[model samples]
Target chain A: MLALIRSEWLKIRRSVIWLLLLVSPGLAGLIGLFGVREEQPGGPFPWLIALALMTALHAMLFLPLLTGVYAALVCRYEHAGGGWKQLLSLPVTRTRVYIVKFLFVMGLVALTQLLFLAVLLLIGTAKGGGGAIPWSELLGSVGRGWLACLPLAALQLAVSTAWSSFAAPLAVNVVFTIPNMLVANSADYAPYYPWVQPLLAMMPHQNGYDFGAFTLPSLTLLSVVMGSFVVFFLGGWAYFARKAV
Target chain B: MSLRILSAELLKIRRKFIWFLIFLGPIGVVGLQAVNFGLRYDYLVGKVYRDDLWGGLIENVTILMVPTLFIGLAILASMVAGIEHQTNSWKQTLALPVTRTQVFTGKFLLNLLLLLVSTTLVAAGTIVLGIVLGFGTGIPYGVLLKACYYPFLAIVPFIALQNWLSVTFQNQAFPLTVGIAGMVVSMFSIRFGDWFPWKWPYLINAAKEPLYSVACGLAFGLVVLAAGLAHFVRKDVK
Candidate 1:
């Protein structure tokens, strides 16, 4: 698994996709700065809320798309370069290869979320003075957001790997994101849509730490991640194992 | 020969799973609008955000979905062009009797058609939501058409931009990133309004009253499209 991950990392380092992964989060953060500038100071929350919302919107719409494209790009290394046959020809099990690849992709996405948070933290601190930052809230939001996106990341990896078309998974993300955003607003549906769960998890209800209401979201997200991982990993293994170069 | 190449390229796109993305675009938009309508119907029962269904459609659908839609179109367009690069199939395809221009045009036209189909679904969905919400009766047909026309027009340049990027980069991420970055910039650029092409699509979709600015939009789209196609045809593909 570690070897596979190293190989995947090496491949990622060689591609233009890495540059994009690095730049997109920073660009999104810079865009957040503009939103912060425009925020009305007299508003209920600090100007940081606007920045947070902007960052969240960018993440919601683009993050899955990025993951889908990256997964597909990584999968392409095997499919197009005759690397799959070479890798499988070795003693390594097909399931192991799939697991490692999936883990690496998921790790990359998690890193992206972290990088985005880092950019936000840096900006927030710079603008709000050093110690005025809401470290706990920001860290909490990042943790929940990453957890909530686990299912979505798994789903995207599966779809992109299965289809091997950059557009297919991205299209799926786009189609689902709209509903995710809309359904997320309602208390009843927010639990089921894993895409929206991250944002909802980070939102504070009227009551403090409404874990009872959040239980469903937590369970749903966990189920989705596990379910999707099984299906996608099995599916990818099947394809990677039997596919002819 | 051109028609043969065009048909073949279209056939390739049809076979790819990306077609599902195209088909799902409008359906997704419409479905979300229905949900939004259902969720906020009580609050918006008799409220007037603007004069007609155009206003309602603008208020409900355009602001939220257009950015996603544009992103979708750009990514799809890029993938359609870039897949050849990823798979090293461009050389194979180009070695055939087809000219590069025909291949590019065929794929470009297919993307445009898909965009239209997706936008049309969104329009129909918006109108349906308007009626269901009891807001459709007050809207004039011209207002609704005008409202729908702007988003479609606004997406033209983006489609063109994606075409250029996809053809140039052969990596779908490049164009996708641009689409996302452009969307983020447009959110901030909304204050500038007329001068910014990035915000034009959303503004056009969000425009309440029928105005002459739409002509500017159409003209801008045509210019961008022509420039994009020109750049695409002249550029050499690896």
Candidate 2:
């Protein structure tokens, strides 16, 4: 399993996809530099406000969409010609292969979240945010957002695994993603929707409400996230196990 | 011969979902508007649509369509190019008795035609939506047509850029990422001013004088398409 995971790492270490990973952090830094002001309308801390805006951009669109791209690309080489047949014909189990790829994608997502954290702090200090860095809150937001992306990543991996054409899965993901503006606003639908979970979880809920659209993560919301993650992860695993190479 | 390539390009995507996407692009945008209106018909009818039902709908729909247009073109270009890339058909297709520019022009036209249909659908759907919502037939035919096509004309350069990237890279990742990035940037492009390429689609909408973005789109589109043609013509296929 470890070697299989290593092989997965070797597959994408030099690909152009890593450059795509920088988009979230790059955008965060840009927003921090421009969009946020010293004294803003929403809250007290400029850094926190910047963080909130950054979370909205990343969590709503970038995180969910990039999850699809990464999952598709991980399966890219395999989908090209005979990579899948050759790998599956080897002396390894399909279960391990599926698990490793999902874990690998989660790792990529975690790295993106961490990069956002790093950029947040870097921008805060560079802008001379006049207070101690809010380490615990930042870490909590990063971790929560990363957690929210799992079901999305898993489902995207399944679709990517099923389709050889990269853009189809991506197109489907993009269609679903376009509605974040509407979907994230619905108290009834936001928790049930996978794409908006990261935005809901990552944004620091003020007085426990999201501009009157949603509240901070409650028990039901957390369960919904975990529930979808299980369904998608297992569904992808089963499909890969029986997938004809 | 160029017409033949255009027809051939259309044939290549026959069994594919590009056609559905061509339709889906506008439908998705219109459908989102449907839901938005369905959810708040009372509020919109009472407050937002006081005097101008069609105008209010037009404004909301235009804002919604730009991001969809940006992302949809990226996918369309990627899929169009990926047909050659995924099956490694570039060499075979190039071996045909045609100039590379014809082939390049053919694909760009297909992308343009697809989006053109989608854009028209948005206009038609907006009308249908207005009629259904009882917006009272004060339909400004010229205004609706201009509202849709102006943005379509303004975004021609991006369609060119997306095709260039999609054709250049065998991997669809780059073009698709750029597409999403452009979408993100365009969401905020209003802040960046009018000259930013991604901002073109939204910039010309409802403007008093709206020729700038269209002119820029045509000129820059020619440049990017020519640059891509040069690369495609010279680069060895292997």
lDDT of 2 by residue, B1-238 (tens): 8778888988999978889988888888888988888888999878988888888899889888988898999999999999999889899998888888888899999999889989999999999998988887889888788779988888888899999999989888888999988888788777776668877777543354677777777888888888888888898876
Q: TM-score winner among the candidates? A: 2
TM-score of 1: 0.82
Q: Tell me how far the alpha carbon of residue B204 in candidate 2 is from the true structure, in angstroms, after superposition.
A: 5.1
Question: Taking the tens digit of each residue's C-alpha lDDT, what string does model 1 give over A1-245?
Answer: 77777777887786787677776567767666665652455333343464455445555555655666667767766655667678878778877877787777777777877887777766666666355666676676667666666666667666666565566667676666656556655667666565666656554332233433344545565675567656655665677567554
Task: Find the candidate with the highest lDDT and give its number.
Answer: 2
Each model's DockQ score: 0.49, 0.75
Chain A fold similarity by TM-score, each prediction:
0.78, 0.93
> What is the CA-based DockQ of model 1?
0.49
Which residue pairs collide, candidate 2?
none
User: lDDT tens digits, residues B1-58, model 1?
Assistant: 7667656667777667666776676666666776666766665544645344457665
List TM-score per model, in order: 0.82, 0.95
State the displacement of the C-alpha of residue A21, model 2, in Å, after optimal TM-score superposition. 1.3
